[model samples]
Target: MAEYEALIIGLEMLVELGIQYVEILGDSMHVLKQIAGEYKCLSLSLAVYPVAARNLLTEFREATWEHIPREENFAANELAQVATSIQMPEDCVQRIIKIGKKSLPSILTTGMEIDVNSAAITEDDWRNPIMTYL
Candidate 1:
């Protein structure tokens, strides 16, 4: 679950940075297959993530996902392990990204952070809202 969430978050971050192409490599064959539309996600919460991920993938002009052996996935494996091992502080307000809903763009435009309430997201960036209930 964490790996899937991390993958989605990473893809969202890349899109926010205006990256137009991506090649995703992962050790989890199931996740790779799900993203590639070769496997069906069985869990509800988990299912939403892949939908969100695929939507984000559309932002890229080119995107590919591949599975690799766990032993060969060195950097990403280490990062995932480290991320899961850390304990969050109580004061840390973890933002929940509703599945299939575009995540708030992390990058500031023109050296200024746009206020969520004030910023007007154009149709070019805003697509269908997939997580209205959340």
Candidate 2:
């Protein structure tokens, strides 16, 4: 159930980025089966998710869902656990980026295309008392 929420979040991120094809890996066979139309989603609470996710899949040229053993999914599991512990500050801008094995790239893209580096300021900016007092 929670796994499908995570998967939905990833799919939403990809849709926002205008990405058209994706390969998704998950350890939840039930969620994958629901997405693949191999099983019926019987839970009233979760019945809507498959339809919503499938609508997102329609935006893609191709979408593949695969199941992997939890032991083989250590990195993602660890990262998700770690993510739940962090609190975002009120002024924080959130971005979602997909990273492959070789390179680190910025995830700060949105419909408005925020430029994170564009707001760079001197050390004095961080020390300004008036701004800090607020």
Candidate 3:
């Protein structure tokens, strides 16, 4: 509903996927901040959007609210326009779906010493469950 289309596009995709976390960054810090509740909303147009944003935010597992320069968000802005004007296939938007892809932390760790003969419990078992799924 805002002037820019990306914010609405990103939000729409998130809702479809049931995404729980999102980072909203834009040169429109005043707008973004107000939406994120970092500032008070003073504009009639701005006021309505933030209310809806906050309500949807409660659904995320963890939403990282932030603000960045417009240069950083240009790509998002363009995408928003495209998304607003037409329907985008999920495959076409794959790049935006995953902004970064770093390999997951090593889950396979081997014991430095063979202590099968000794029964020694390690605290790491509870500290990091994903280390060894087996």
Candidate 4:
């Protein structure tokens, strides 16, 4: 049920992003097969998912579904684990924060000390204060 919900949510996000073509991949063979029309979703509680997912696929000019082995889909598995671990309010909107890779090594290992009282700093200068706090 959670797998199907995730697929529906992902397709909705793609539509919101104005994506016209998409290749959907999932580790759940049952869900993928059901969505692909190769198998029927017999459970009353889960029947809505395949219908919702297929409806979402209509919004795209081209769409394809594929089932991959769970071992090959580590990223999705990790994301599902994270999603299940988080607890949020019903009214709260989810936000995705994009973080860039650090170009410099750790300050602790580099034996660098920060002078927090320095006046020659701009609003964008976050590293110094963060390092000092750490």
lDDT agreement with native, every candidate: 0.70, 0.69, 0.55, 0.72
Tell me how far the alpha carbon of residue 61 in candidate 3 is from the true structure, in angstroms, after superposition.
1.0
Expressed as tens digits, the lDDT of each residue in 1-134 for candidate 2 is 56766666678778878998899888888888998999977665566667666766888889998898877988786887986677667887995544543111111121222222234446579646765687
If the candidates were sorted by their lDDT against the true structure, best first, what order would they fall in? 4, 1, 2, 3
Per-residue lDDT tens digits of candidate 3, residues 19-132? 877776666777676666778665543454555556556667787756666677676668769756764576784433344332222111111122123234476657345545
Kindly give the stretch of ten consecutive residues in candidate 3 with the minimal lDDT sum.
106-115
What's the TM-score of each model vs. the native? 0.57, 0.58, 0.49, 0.58
Q: Model 1 clash pairs?
A: none
Winner by lDDT: 4
Instruction: Write candidate 4's Cα lDDT for 11-79 as tens digits.
Output: 767897899999988889999899889998766556666777787789999998888898899878688
Candidate 3: stretches off by over 4 Å: 1-5, 77-134
Pick the winner on lDDT between candidates 1 and 2: 1
What's the best-to-worst order under TM-score? 2, 4, 1, 3
Write model 1 residue lDDT over 11-114, tens digit each, in one string. Answer: 86798789999999888899888888989886644666566677778899999888889899898868869866876679989956343444333221113222
lDDT of predicted model 2 = 0.69
| TM-score of candidate 1 against the unseen true structure | 0.57
Residue 22 of model 3 has an lDDT of 79
Worst 10 residues of 1 by lDDT: 106-115
Pairs that collide in candidate 4 are: none
User: Which of the two candidates, 2 or 4, achieves a greater lDDT against the reference?
Assistant: 4
